[model samples]
Target: MKRRLEPGRLVIASHNKGKIPEIAALLGPYGMDIVSAGELDVPEPEETGTSFAANAELKARFSADLTGLPALADDSGLCVEALDGDPGIFSARWAGSGKDFGRAMELVERNLAAKGPEAGRDAHFVCALSLCWPDGHIVTVEGRVDGHLVWPPRGDKGFGYDPVFQPWHHDITFGEMDPDRKHAMSHRADAFRKLVAAVF
Candidate 1:
């Protein structure tokens, strides 16, 4: 039997502003209070797990234990099929030196140079969400968005690898889409939709 999800004020176990607001907005309709870990100044656990699900649970369980409240954590990133999922977990660090994505994208372009775009230059964004209760029980869900890659990032909306990832449904990249449009189709949105239906 599956455990029930208890609802109340919960902590979003992450410091990324890009992720925080979208999650909060999604949770608002559920009548659940959403608080960020940064707001509470809680220390994040090291994400040593090799998989997205493992990493999300590590952080969520840690935050739930710390805040004594149900907590939600998400591990997300872009995965290039040609790169053999090269920046899967290291997507954040890929942008070395002051979180400069321009440099990061440059690295990806360089890495793919030998492979050539036609040789399976496809990519996708993956998101894993974990919700942990104060009682030590946890539940997890995952979402992914597949699409081919486009070089030389585009637009100014959204953050992270948004500029380079263009979902299968649209010709424009995520960064070029409107905020509401991106939020509706993103992997994060897909995961949160399941979370809302299952928990909130």
Candidate 2:
């Protein structure tokens, strides 16, 4: 049987400025008193896990254990097929210590250019979410949205590699879409839906 989350305080176990708000927005409808690990001054744990789900659980478990509150963490990234998932788990690392996504995006474009015209632009975003309780019980779910990469990027909204990705069947890139539209079909939202069904 799956565990259910009672209406109460919950910690969002992430330090990324871009991610915390997106997550908080997703959890807003649930009526839990949402607070972030950053807000609580909880230090980020090393994400040594090999996959998104593992990393998410690692963060969630760390925060939940420390704060004695239910914690939610998300590990997500962009995987490019042409690059054989070059930056998959290292998506954040690709941005370096400064979190310079402009440089990271340039690296991706440069690498793709190295592959020549024949190399496909096929790509997708993956999000894995983990919810952990103080006693160690945890639940995890993953979601993905297929898309292709675009040059010069687009839009000023959204964060990370959103500017360069155009989901299949969408005319505009994720960065160009309205937040509500993006939220409706995002990889994170996909995972959140599953999470709500399982734990709410």
lDDT of 2 at 193: 96
In terms of TM-score, which candidate is strongest? 2
Cα lDDT for residue 93, candidate 1: 85
Cα lDDT tens digits for candidate 1, 92-175: 889974888888888888899988647677899999999999998888999888897788899889888889889997999998
Question: Candidate 2 regions off by >4 Å?
Answer: none
Pairs with backbone N, CA or C atoms under 3 Å apart (clashes), candidate 1: none
TM-score of every prediction relative to native: 0.94, 0.98
lDDT of 2 by residue, 37-151 (tens): 9999999999999999999999999999999999999999999999999789899999999999999999999999999999999999999999999999999999999999999
Pick out the ten consecutive residues of candidate 2 with the lowest summed lDDT: 18-27
